[model samples]
Target: MAARRKANRILAAVLVPLTLLTLAGMAMLWPSGSKDGISLANPYSAAPGVTFDTGKIQSVVEESCMQGSTAPGQSPDTGGQPAPAGSDCMFAFTEPDQGGSPVKVVVNPEVAQSHGVKPGDQIRYLNLSNAPGAAASQGSPAYIFVDFVRTLPIVILALLYALVVIAVARWRGLRALLGLVGAYFVLAGFMLPGLVEGKPPLLLALVGSTVIMIGVLYFAHGFSARTSTALLGTMFGLAITALLAAWATDAANLAGVGSHDATTLINTSANISISGVILCGLIISGLGVLNDVTITQSSAVWELYELAPGTSARKLFTSAMRIGRDHIASTVYTIAFAYAGAALPILIIVMLYDRPLGDTLTSAELSEEVIRTLVGSIGLVLAIPVTTLIAVLVVKATGVRTAGQSAVGVPDEDRRPHGTSGAGAINADDVDDTGALAAAAFERRSRQSTEGSADPATTRRGRRADRG
Candidate 1:
């Protein structure tokens, strides 16, 4: 026990420093860009053409007309010629298409002249339509449209998430953080890269998810029976979710849903598969529920064991299952509400269409969300039973009892020697009998010993000793 404790201390000392160093490294290597920005390697690199229906023309116009103007500023001409006054002022029109016609954009003469544009000068269009081109474009437009606005939130959210996790869970949170980092690396560095390189998307997602589960559960909870049970439950749940997602996606015949963005990707990268991307989404979506269910089930089992050490495996399972039942009920609602919250606008639009309720519910887009929620909920529900069963078996098989054997029903009498009565078990007569017998025996032995003594001095010394 002492040795094990010493080893644990040593391991903790080593791990603490290593973990700090790793976090420091992550801080140093963290991306400094914004979240909404485009990337050079993004598959959606092609520019999309703008098409407007008459019904949506007003919205298009409103979107395009929102612009800000800058005041004119004077600068020295490149040719050392006298520049016109107010030539540096600029006006921006937001509408790409004006009045149902392809709009002709003209930079103001004063602004153009100040920027060295002659009459009939054609300004090159910097296409910020997709990620790759947007990434290539440098300066204020790129910063405003892509980096500062687009990508900043992702970075900030990531940092905040890390801090919140660490604050809430402490050491386990740190381990979970490491596991999350590992999962991201596996997904982005391995799974994504492999899929981009033409690997199967479904296979990629499955393997990546498995790797993530193993790393996360073991690292955060350690390689114990409880962790193993949770991992098993989570993996099973993930598999169920993946299978269901695949079937639902095929049945619904879901085409790529990203509007112009998806079209841009299709045009830019023939190697990229939309089907694979869809599968990846399914795997990612189910992971949180899987983790939640497994962890909850494992906790329930252990808590049951702590509460009743000598509890039979069956009783423990029953007790734990009560908790699992509650978890399932709440989690099902949670999954539904979460997806519903995200798709509320879509649902509202469908409702406004005044189609039959059945037809609206069966719509492809709505059905996709429904399938996701149901499949994930089913996976979570199944995970509870698997985790509970595993935990019960593990606790029972290990025969490890918590402190205080009293709770486990080990009686005090069984712990004591036979014929040894407790304080309350002894009577006054028994004590008096024992005392009198001991005194009589001692007195007889003393008289015999004194009579057998040959010398008067010895007898006298014995008597004096006895008196004393």
Candidate 2:
């Protein structure tokens, strides 16, 4: 307990200063004009652009056909022909422009007037779009599209998930949060930048993933043998996945299926390689499953060891293999289902085309998904055995005693019993004698009890003599 507390204290002391220093360095590195030298528009630029606030919309004017136009066969626009000139059938508001203060903006007032608002009435703007060249100013309201309503439920769900994680996992959840932040930094500060700089995608992925795995697993699970074993197993699995992905990419003649997005990225940045980016995608796709399987296997092995510490390595390995088998079954299905869910629309489109199933399966896009799912599943499946084996070997080699041994020590005589031995005083015969002696003592007590009992014949003879 004392050691744990001291370790915590040490970590706190080191981490606090390190965190402060890191933040200070980041602050120093940031452009003076913008926070972190990052612009929402041009994220990769050295100098960030100035920020401006645009005024919000005061009200919105929505126009629709009157009840008279509700006939099913009627055209949707039968009753409305835009807002009439000079009519109070428009909404108006104010907005700010770039490098300028807020100015009045006039929207169609038809909907507002219909809702009982007049020229001098004040109304809140629910949705507004900021025009280009907006200026930063106080009391400026922002506008959003009416579709923003859809985000409410999503936000609520996110909050609920966060609450559940915190409530259930507690400190581990906090560590996970920290790990998430660390991951963002790694991706933004290291991985993305390195990839954009034209580094080998596979190499970058390996290094970045390694860093993330170490940071996240250690932070969440703490420094322990199980965590280390899991990390080792995960790395092994990742290596296999990487190698297979590389081989498949070459053998299958994958051209990355580049879309407009990739083209746009290429047009914007001269330093990035499209093919490398695709490879990076493949590597990253499998990383999560690798971590999950390895960690799960490691945990299972440790728990099994705890349950039966005296069990031989072969037995432990067999027991862990059973767990690995179950994990492999579920995890393979999980990967396939996950991809299916993501590509359901594509699958539906393919089915609608009435294409041959074999042809559709062999298509480049579908093939990519198949390769990703299979490669990741393979990694997950392989991680379990590797982790279990490592864990068994480690636990056996470490020779850590079980909890049962703490209360009682082996009997001294049994520890070195008399036997026919040359070097060691104890031998197998002494153990045999101990067992034999215990059995013989039990048999002797039984015989004596039977002999000491009064004889029925003697009692009968005594009765006969008395009668005479």
* TM-score for each candidate, following the candidate numbering: 0.57, 0.60
- For model 2, residues 278-375, the per-residue Cα lDDT tens digits are 67777788777788888888888766654434446776687678778888998898889989999897788778889898888778657778878877
Give lDDT for model 2.
0.60
Predicted structure with the largest lDDT when compared to the true one: 2
**TM-score of model 2 relative to the true fold?**
0.60
Please give the lDDT score at residue 27 for candidate 1: 43
Report backbone clashes per prediction.
12, 21
* Top model number, TM-score: 2
In candidate 1 the C-alpha lDDT for residue 153 amounts to 64
| 129: Cα error in model 2, Å | 11
